[model samples]
Target: MTRLSSPAHLRQVRTGNMHAVLVAMLDGPASRAELAQRTGLTKATVASLVEPLLGQRILAEGAVVNAGRGRPSRPLRFAATGPVAIGAEINVRHLGVTVQRLDASTEFERRIEVDNCRATAADIVTRLADLIRTAIAACGRDPLGIGLAVPGIVQDGAVVHTPNVPSLNGIHLGDQLAAELGRPGTTVAVDNEANLAALAHVWPHRLAGDDFVYVSGDVGIGAGIVIGGAMFRGRSGFAGELGHVIIERTGHPCPCGSRGCVEQYAGLDAIFQAAGKRDLAALLLALDHGDPRALAAVETASAALGAALAALINICDIETVVLGGSYAALFDHIAPGVHTELDTGVLAATRRPIHLTTSAFGRAAVTRGAAALITRRHCLEPNLLLPPGRRQ
Candidate 1:
């Protein structure tokens, strides 16, 4: 027996009209002409797409109010009530999970701390499945998909490589966890944490444009790239492995078998070790107490980070850079050194316009980006919202 009948699923897929409805709502309330202009589809095409969606109650039409000297425009908007999607961000030390409607209004949220990233892949899957099940029970919504943002390399929805964390070196983390969840038709999506943070942070400021970079420092360092308004996950899905890039040939030994890697200096462990503390909070407390050693370590890390960012600016030329993660709070202390490096290292022609700022979402941005990843753009398709067995 075919576990899930394709013909039946296809019929259901055709009935929902979710894609067209979501596209309409994304443009805000608009008339046919307004939506057409914003979406770049002809007015007739917009009408054709919207009619079925309207019938399904996914798209709502308002009164055709009269506009003087023109056709009365009937505005359309997405129905506020519909299926909601869940986004989960699994980091080295914690998980940030959120649930929101397809229209982007957030519902409930929760965070939980699990075992260290050193936990075996099986352990990770079991614990993650439990967390997700708990979230589903709490949210009480039909989840369309699950988006996971992890601190490592992702290719075709799997964690094929995690350089900083040895236990996850070769695990197909996504597929295993998805299977453990027992939601066969549920869509599971995965991406590097930095990439998701970049998407989550840049989406709100998208009116300014899409080309930007997101850099985060935590247990490890990572970067997410956005070019031409879309994530550019380069060949082999390791494009943004900025943390492993050799900064100094003989600086310090990194666990990834490299010396003087960015993570050796910019990662939380390095900062803590340099400050002679077990935690970043303790180091910050020492800094507050006028502990010179702690303060010096912070400055050194900042200068190294600044130099690295400047080098990247010379190469990528992104318009903006957003810093995130557990160590993002250090941006305030290191701004001076970062400024100094950017002033000196970036090419003169492309230097002045680049802006560096701390991420507004802080540690939660990567998780939010994971959620967005499951539902945004050409990425969204019928299978995105389909039940598990029907999905590829």
Candidate 2:
């Protein structure tokens, strides 16, 4: 069988025409001819690639539309039903789970603000298992997989380290959750929240050539980097620990056994401390109303973030920085401080404008991206999940 080369030059590990067709459809609904033209595949090749998807109910045909005159071509679109994907996030102050289908539509969601920092790993896993059960029920069919968004480093199925949630450290969360759920064919995948957050930008958008930095601010701070439309996971999976970047040589001690780290100054806790407010909602309201204290505290934290980002931009040469999590909510108020610090710290800011934007997924970025990870795996390379004797 002849393999179709990807038109966009993506790193496709599998040799097949299916990936090309799916990638073309991501732009929008397209007819077979349109898909073939865009993907650089022959018309017959497109039909062959699409046949399996249509049979599996992964792709559906819309009504026949008149283009020129002779024959109307039915457009192909991602099916909204069946094969749902699950994504979960374990935050210090919240637990968020998103049930999404292949088309990125939310079927069901559960979010509760429960402080799990002090909760034991077993307890956290138990809560997540219950939530996963609910999501699985909502799916009502064999799901693609479940992806976990953790605030810590994840190596294998275990949490490597987390400064914000110490109880999660050294816990085999993926394996435990799989064992607890005990549902056959329900696979579990895990990764850092920020890394998945970065993947969110590229996943649904399908902008494989974009290069940017995604910074997530919450109880803690972390970064996700996208270079050439792919995630730069670095030599180790621990690449984007932007929070641990040192800002002051002898400043406040950090939970990661460091002093003067970026998180110490710009993290949610630091901003809350600076504002003298125990509640974030109240502080955000005050900042919106132009309260002097709230403004000052947010500005101070934004400056720290900018300082850390300057070094990052220089090293990565990324022009875009996307603020996610709490940062997105406070973007209007804190953007100036980040810009000012960038102008001062970044060497090439004068030549190239440093563009900043808010995440499209907002606080749900990580979990949604986690779900997208599984969807991407299935779309780009379906052979891994193929049933025995199922022809590719």
Going through the candidates in order, what is the number of backbone clashes in each?
5, 0
Question: Any idea what lDDT model 1 has?
Answer: 0.73
Question: What lDDT tens digits, residue by residue, belong to model 1 across residues 205-314?
Answer: 36326777788788788888888888888878888787887789998988777899988887888888888998757887887897988888878888788788888878
lDDT tens digits by residue: candidate 2, 143-239: 7788999998888778888979999999877778888888645678999999888887888684323999999899889898898898888876788
**Against the hidden reference, what TM-scores do the models get?**
0.83, 0.92
lDDT of each candidate versus the true structure:
0.73, 0.83
Query: Once superposed on the true structure, which residue ranges of model 1 sit more than 4 Å away at CA?
Result: 1-21, 31-37, 40-48, 54-57, 60-76, 202-208, 288-290, 349-353, 377-392
Pick the TM-score winner.
Answer: 2
Q: For model 1, name the residue pairs that clash.
A: 184-388, 185-387, 185-388, 185-389, 186-388
